[model samples]
Target: MIQSIQYSLDVIQDEARQLVQKGVVSRQQPIYVLCNYIPAREWGWVESELEKSDFLLRDRIGDLISHENWEND
Candidate 1:
């Protein structure tokens, strides 16, 4: 579970940096501009901005499942 969250955070940060670099997001503003107000969900969206990006998220999740995944499952 910890691993999953860590990977997701990593991908989100990577994507956020990319967005800032591309001018899609402003450095002075919060990441919520490109993503929703919710950091995790918005970060997840960032992970899926492109095709096969979903796989990027899934790869990070690995075999660790969490309460959130269970409730949604």
Candidate 2:
């Protein structure tokens, strides 16, 4: 489950950064704006899991929220 969340976050961040780099959006914008572009099917479970335990997730990831591949990166 954690792996799935990490994967979704990675893709979301990558696409978000690309959009920012292209001037399509600003880095200061909320990430939820770019989330619509991500596949809902793949992210649905992750979103549910996050909602179920938002605090636990935050504790698990800590300050690595913006880091890609939390296990290795």
* Strongest candidate by TM-score: 2
lDDT of 2 by residue, 6-73 (tens): 44444544665677677776655554454466566555655554454332232323222344433655
lDDT of 1 by residue, 1-73 (tens): 3333433545555655666667665655633454442366345545544223333332322211111222454
- Mark the 10 consecutive residues where model 2 has the least summed lDDT: 55-64
Query: All candidates' TM-scores?
Result: 0.38, 0.44
In order, how many clashes per candidate? Answer: 0, 0
> In lDDT terms, how accurate is model 2?
0.49
Stretches of candidate 1 off by over 4 Å are: 1-7, 36-73
Cα deviation in Å at residue 38, candidate 1? 11
Residue 61 error, candidate 2, Å: 17
The candidate scoring highest on lDDT is: 2
TM-score of 1: 0.38
List candidate 2 stretches off by more than 4 Å: 1-7, 39-73
* lDDT scores of the candidates, listed in order: 0.43, 0.49
